[model samples]
Target: MSEPHPASVPLLEVAGLRVSAGSRMLVKDFALTLARGERVGLIGESGSGKSVTAAALTGLLPEELQICGTVRLDGVHYNLVGASDRQMSRIRGQRTGMVFQEPLSALNPLMRVGRQVAEALTQHGTLSGHAAAARSVELLASVQLPDPAEAARAYPHQLSGGQRQRVMLAMALANDPDLLICDEPTTALDVSVQHQMLQLISDGVARRGSGLLFITHDLAVAASICDRILVMRDGVLVEQGATADVFTRPQHDYTRGLLAASDLDATDSSGRLFTVSSAAGYVPAAARKRVPAAEPAVPDVPNSTVSESARPDDGAHSDIRDAEPLIRVSGLNRTYRRGRSSLFRAPSEVHALRDVSFEVAAGQRFGIVGESGSGKSTLLRILAGLDQPTSGSVQVAGNEVAGSRENELLELRRQLQIVFQDPMGSLNPRMRVRDLIAEPLLLPGEPVAARHHAGRVAEMLNAVGLPPDAAERFPHQFSGGQRQRIAIARALICEPRILVADEPVSALDVSVRAQVLNLLADLVDKYRLTLVFVSHDLGVVKHLCDTVAVMHQGRIVESGPTGQVYAAPEHEYTQRLVASSLSLQPGSSLPT
Candidate 1:
């Protein structure tokens, strides 16, 4: 009924943590232990109740949701699970600090970043103006912000995603709480930044002698940060063991499947990616871990410039040299002015993309890989007709992008589609799934009939492996992976010649990522659609893209087949990128 207490009380303890709605249970019988200065990882997929468990520990769960548990932070002697709002307000950041996944949303946009962090300190303790300000700068510096003084003056919007996350970490550690809970903190970050962020968190916690409860869907990240791991599925703890044992010798089927899905080497002996079989509510068996059941028919990276019809099995390495390019760019450049300047000083310009040149062939899976601010999104936006470059010759679907008429631009848009990084931002929550998917089907003068759109929406839902009933529900009702599928379906309804995905799977659960990747590949092959994928994930890019282009400091540093570039990177930046890829596997370490 109760956990075995250590001689010196554990830093945090949970017993019979249960979160439930009127009838549905989100989390059940969840229990965990964390000692001071110890790091633990709670690993699960979306809807596995990992987040809910964290929320319960912090007493942040909604009022409507019923919570029953005993959450105790040693020496505090208060029940965190049943704590009132008044009690939780004092306890939350003071005794148990937390870092959420999205830093921008967590931070107030109008407030200066320094004030926001200082406010966290002022809440639990007393520190006046200059002292708090100085402390804020010190905290930012501790998290490795480039210029702590300048960063303290900047707002949340001014900082990069990675920097914002670092600020969040700083804010969480402001009070030096005994327990630190980080929920998917590095999910949206680039691998290089993610590694640094993890290090920052670890070092910060270690210095404070704080216990850590890291919740994440990424097994490798969990492995890298945590000493112990708890595997959860559908709200129940399937297994609990040391990190090394759980990662390598997982006994639970779900844990094994998760590992298999997260495997960078998720391939058959012949080198073809496995095609996941998805049924209605499909759960992969343990046997499916190593065996490649299906050789996904994909266009292999060509050895030489030739034609479109060549395959890897054919042993003839030919590329689409003679074929008409779907999207072409030459000497592309995009510059932005960040802040206003006085008459005495000139305004600074941020050159996002400089002299970037690349050609995407028809039906080719072209991947653009880079770190943040490396012009990956800028290049993708230019390709999608969303943004313009000052100096470049860009032709989309054989139409000049720079000098296109309104109707001509609309035509180009119809020929090309884009799926943004956050699907929730793109999809309207008020609309039904059918309406969201059918929004693209409506034309300027000719509105598609509701009945016709409904039929099409149902078909698209099925195509993405969602149930037909999902069409009736709202976007909020669906899980993240399902919402992404809906976003993909919406992008496809227009039947664009090209599909542009910007870090599509970066925010998804590892197991769900594989399914979505499989679905994307299937759709690309089925419709013979050219894919322009932009991401920091080299492994994901190499898995899906036939060719890859590496971007660094607003320039094309490397361009070649994914295999070749990964194997032998010519540029210094690219070599660093390849070397800095943070993985659970051996031979990789976070940047110091």
Candidate 2:
């Protein structure tokens, strides 16, 4: 993935690294040495110590975590481990730069983007006044942000996810540090934006001759961006080699499982997607010789119109071909009024959804694929009865929802449920898992007996592949995948006929994403529910959806059978989106 660098003169070196949180060890004796202009990828699942290792290297770990490591930069003579705040502060932006996962949280919401970049410049007294401001815009332009000057004046919330990420890159490269550490910086970005961001990071590192440490759970992304790949699991490095060697010939079982799980093309003879599970000993589907168990332990819930035997084996919805659409939308439009331009001027209108219309038949898996700000979310919210459309007709289960009041949405709400993108944000941290799942059942002016609530919660937990005891825990106590399962359980507790999943697996690791996708597929099939899945990942949509609608700007640019659309996209935007979707094969060429 990169040209060989001279090893005799390494750019940065770390040895005898270990991080501990009180009695539990987070990272154990991790060591690495990077040459100039080298890009190394640290690949791992959530809670596998990948982020912790980056934090330890960058002096960003929490104060309570005990760190014992020897970090030597190209020009630094002192050990970076246990350095005082003053010394570390000087080294942070001047010598080494960090790009965190969530740029929204990392950036100041109140500050203008350009001012933030300028602050990064003046932190080390490198530039000030107009010079710093000019340099900030220059940095933004270097990251390929459209209209850099205008973007500089906008606040972080005003910009899209990709734009905010570009701002983070601009600030990270403000001083051209010798070492750049990026922690899942493109995890939540869409395919095109992620590709652009990766290219920007690569270009920035190359131009500055910096050693790069890119930490992420995405194996294909690592394969594309990094020269060397290091596989980590449970706080231990399992494999390390060149990009081609590690991915093509994985020696470790965990690495092999990760590769298998990431291969969206691979499936069993029965068309069931192959998924890996560390809790089950990290075995691939080929080794196991069986597909994931589609039949969950819980029995079917109420309001199921179709039986499990009527479900399609290959994700086809042939049985619902003659049925009326479960969800119908016509000329859907959502426009938000911005604040007044001036004291007396009229407000600007942001058209989030422009004449969007789609239909999902009962027992069909319908997918919506698009980048951010493409009206996918707005459409989902309208379908879920959470947001009203501006000028359109939205009918779910034969009931109009666009102009319905809160009192008129009881039956619609009972028929439709939503699973959000970020489960951690949606799930109440203070509530127990049981109560969280059962809360939907205890609707307004309706109270169920404690025994019935417990029974329903346990049944949902089993259906989603969670243990019964998990109901006793809180949201914070589970892994990312487990948290999503809990969210799924809650969404299904009432057994809604229509399921609206908004990027449910976008933020998860590859393995966990596979597990969740499989779980969703199985549950959707077994329960014969109508699924309206929204995602930016084209590959995931292609894998899970029988029908797909390609949205761009606020309208559906293309719509057809998933295979037909993916095989031959008609719209220019859909064609570009397909081209930008990243998929890496063994021994395949990577971007340089």
Candidate 3:
């Protein structure tokens, strides 16, 4: 028979791919065909087997995982099922490159990032030693990393999230593989950095005529990069078609739900957000009923715990601008010593916050928006009394936070609580959800009776839209969204007047993110709590916050009503941020 036509041979092909962990199947009947220079996206929520499918394709799955599949890469055998380590290793970098979701976890903390890139090149003898080292710097530079030479010498922990991700990209592209697999590589990135990353990935693949397998939970991101899109749900492909076709004319209910969730502008008349569920389908707001909160065990903060009727939209607080400020920061400055660069040099100081000042009125929904390294976290720490400012005034509910001693913070602790970004990291894995939610009540100088713990935990679980049985389960037993609910329940257990959420929904899938955002909105309204929400997502901040403060380079660059600021951002940085944000609305496109 004559040799197959060059155009007919696909760059990557998969048939009947399935992944199982014991009796449970993680991925089912996955199939794909990608031609050279083509881009395809696998879109799904968490636990939907997007990553599992990727792992199976890359031969990176654990040995314990049962995979029955065929993955064919160009120049490779027709069937790569059960490929051995030696066989897989030969093509891992030279033929296929995989960029993982979390670069921090994927990268070696002890190794310098540049050295890691060099190692990728040194493997398979493409380049070694000095040549590889120089090529590594070139790769880093190609990814548009600022000061690539300096970045090369730094460890993964030393770099920002965006920088670390760029480093991962540098490594993934070091060998110009025939196929590139990026697994939610931009999930944790800020919109601006995420835009750059997507462009870089596109450019990299375009330059080498490489086929791309991009996996993500974000429809906007998938739209920005992929030519074709495959919607995965519950370990199976529900729909597959051209990117525009699938997005605009979704045939499956799950696909429609994903689209509905992605359209952040869409909301019910009551301003309730929408979320998708495998069980209940998708609609206005979460399906679960809001559970009433238990009465405060201690003297609650004045005007802190308002009834549902007192919600801001109900016209109960029309004069919110004239209300007494719940939080005030004036001339805030936080500096940390970096020790001496060299023994004889004067000590270096990193200015984490510079003259940062803002006020949150009682029951006000305040937002702080900034990219990484913009001092948002530093400001949050000072507000929470976790760190002292070098020079500033931080008053929460008329109590001093900056420079306050631990013993002097009991009242403040009861008045304010924080919900961190990564619930898994913030929560104790070994503790039952009951204990975790009730732990706040056991704070120093404030103790609730053991008899009340069960009642309170159950109430909190219901308040956060979780099942009552969730209180007895461990954090590991819950999904990412569920774990975040647990974190939120724990933060609200003490009925704190102020809730400071730091990037709480940044890591969630679109559907889950909508659920969390809506929950936070409803909780803030119901409890009349002062919310200081920090996020890099401009769209989210605009949707949820009344007032927003734009931060950049350790200072508050702009502060005004969210609508005004978003409509016409004055600061250049703020303008860039607004332009860089991705939207799934009609006519939305990736920023140039």
lDDT of 1 by residue, 1-592 (tens): 0233454778888899889998999999998888878889998888889988888888888889999978887766678877789888888788778999999889999999999989988877657678988999998998999999999889999999999999999999988888899999998888788878988988888888788999998877887778889998999999998876776567777777677677544444333333223121222222223335473222242311211111221222245544678888999999988675777777899999899888888877888999988999888777777787888889999878875656668888788888887899999999888889998878878876656778788888999999998888998888888899999999998889999999998888777787788788778888889889999998788777768899988999899877778889999988888876766642125321
Candidate 2 segments whose C-alpha is farther than 4 A from its true place = 1-7, 109-111, 278-316, 586-590
The digit string of per-residue lDDT tens for model 3 on 1-592 reads 0122376689888999999999998988999999988899899988899998988888888889999978887677547778888888888888889999899899999999889999999887889999999999999999999999999999999898889988988888888888899999998888889988998998999898788999999888888888899999999999999876787667888887887666565554455555564312332111111223464311232312212111223344456767989998999999999878898899998999998888889888888999988999999888888999999899998789877899898898899999999999999999889889999889566676544789988888899999998877899999889999999999998999999999999888888888898899889978879999999988788778878899999999999877778889999999999988876532245422
In candidate 3, which residue pairs get closer than 3 Å at backbone N, Cα or C atoms, i.e. clash?
none
TM-score of every model versus the real structure? 0.84, 0.88, 0.89
lDDT of 2 by residue, 110-176 (tens): 9999999999999899999999999999999999999999999999999988899999999988998
Give each model's whole-structure lDDT.
0.80, 0.83, 0.83
Q: Would you give me the overall lDDT of model 2?
A: 0.83
Ranking by TM-score: 3, 2, 1
Judged by whole-model lDDT over C-alpha atoms, candidate 3 comes out at: 0.83
